[model samples]
Target: MLKVAIVGYGGIAKGPHTSAWKKIENAKVVAACDIRPERLDLAKSAFSSNIGLYEDYKEMIDKEKPDIVDICTPNYLHSPIAVYALEKGAHVICEKPDAISVEDALKMQAAKEASGKVLMTIRNNRYSAGSQYLKHLVTSGQAGEIYSGRCGWIRKRGIPGKGGWFTTKAQSGGGPLIDLGVHMIDLAIYLMGNPKAVSVTGNTYSKFADNTEKADSSHATFGQAKEDGIYDVEDLAMGFVKFDNGSCLQIEFSWASNIKRETRFVQLRGTKKGLEFRDGIIDVFDGGRNTKRARIKHNVDARKLDTGIAKVLNGHEANIRHFVDVITKGVEPVFTIEQGVDMIKILSGIYESAQTGKEVLL
Candidate 1:
């Protein structure tokens, strides 16, 4: 049996990660760690009553000696914790953005190499039903030669953890660009055949730091919001990326912006047909002039694509299952540490470009 211990018993680790572990055979959550005593209680409620809980991650890892260390902590702690876990002979599966900076990401990659242990980050978006269909379209020569794409997750007013780690640059990296950007950006690039991002140019804004508006988005309740916390990170970020394969991606992410309701989408322009995944559904557009017709467009789902419906619809749960499979059953990994490093490099480059007001080459 593979023993798994999770760091940061937050909403994600408690809800999706633990729940998925319950459903997976031969893998058990042996322990959980968090700084907050309340969170440890919550973890106990979520997991077994006999499950070990710790306030210090190092102490937990040292004592438990878990085979797997799942990290769902704040952005800044990802690298340090992952490195320590890997060195202590534990496979690591971390939540998104990989690491806050390129340097930290590289450290994780190096540790994984030296330890000879698996390291996978949560690219949960890739496991979504729509995302799976899109992947089929791209790989099956339907969405041929994906050339350009546009992806974004924008919110009119949905800043999470107003004055907490989510708002602090040092703790959570930079606002939506790192928090939410990793989701859509990684999905887009994965669908686009994981093209190498060569250069990036971007801009960031912090307009709604003190707005104190009631959030209409369900996502606003993710992190605990403080009364008067630091809101130093950007609320909005726009960027463009040029891939090595000549394909480019345009991205925009905002925790708060003066726009319509919350929407998350990914659109790709391909030679044969274009693909768009907005909200949850996917649609394919065929601009080929057949007869005197203008264009052809149709909705596509897992049923139509014949891809087996996932037992776990939640992408987070499915991703966790995949992580378990890769470790216990020797299944090939879909997410790699190298990709995590590249993802951090792209995000960090965009932030640097946002500051320097110039394109940053990767």
Candidate 2:
């Protein structure tokens, strides 16, 4: 069994990461570290009281000598924690929105290269039943050559941690763009053969920043909101990415908007047929006659879908299994560091576009 040490025993760690490890056969949560003792206590109680817990992550890593280190900290801490874990000679598995900036993401990638250890991010949607089903059709020529796509995650009223690190542009980077956008756009681009994004035109808005006063904060990842926290990030963001393959992707996402309702989906246009996967349902539209009419759908638990930009299986179960398999079974992780680099590039470009008021060239 591979020994694992998890950092940040908060909502994500306790909820999905730990739960997924429980279902895996070759991994064990031997140690966990967090800034708060109460959070560590929660992890101990949730996983096993016998498992070691510490307040300092480096101390835990030094003493436990885990084979794998999982980083579940805030947006700013991801790259730093991941680099330290990699330097400690452990395979690193970090959460989404890789890092605060492309520069840090590049540093993490460099550290992983020097460590000669496996570095994986949680894009578990790639292995989901619905995603896997569609990937089969696209790659097997059933869906044909995928050209362009439009995708988004819209919310009527949703702003995470109204005044915490999530709202601070310095800590959480940007609002829904960095948090929710990463989860949705990455999946769509991955299905498009991971094309090189050449440029991006983007915009961001913060119409609901005043909601911090209401303190009705309910974010899918961070949980309840902090009434008196900083609210400097945008509530909504939209962008169009141009790929080197001549393909384009238009994306829009919001934490709080005056939209009809909250929904997440990706509509891909291919030469042979079209695919739209929304709310765990994959719809294939093949023009007129002589088109394959097979529709692949699954009735997944709806409760989990409401949590951020998740997939049929989310990144929890499938990602944990893939991380373990990469170590034990010598299987390659579908989303590699190169892909992570690509994701960071596009995201950073989006932010630059928003800031400079000009289309950013990647």
Q: Which of the numbered candidates is closest to the native, going by highest TM-score?
A: 1
Model 2 C-alpha lDDT per residue in residues 110-134, reported as the tens digit of each score: 9999999999988866666667766
Q: Could you tell me every candidate's TM-score relative to the true structure?
A: 0.94, 0.92
Q: Which sections of candidate 1 miss by over 4 Å?
A: 288-311
Weakest ten-residue segment in model 2 by summed lDDT: 302-311
Task: Name the regions of candidate 2 deviating beyond 4 angstroms.
Answer: 212-224, 289-314
Residue-level lDDT of model 1, residues 152-211, one tens digit each, is 999988888789889989999889999999999999999899999999999999999879
- Score candidate 2 by lDDT: 0.82
Q: What residue pairs are clashing in model 1?
A: none
RMSD of 1: 3.3
lDDT of each: 0.87, 0.82
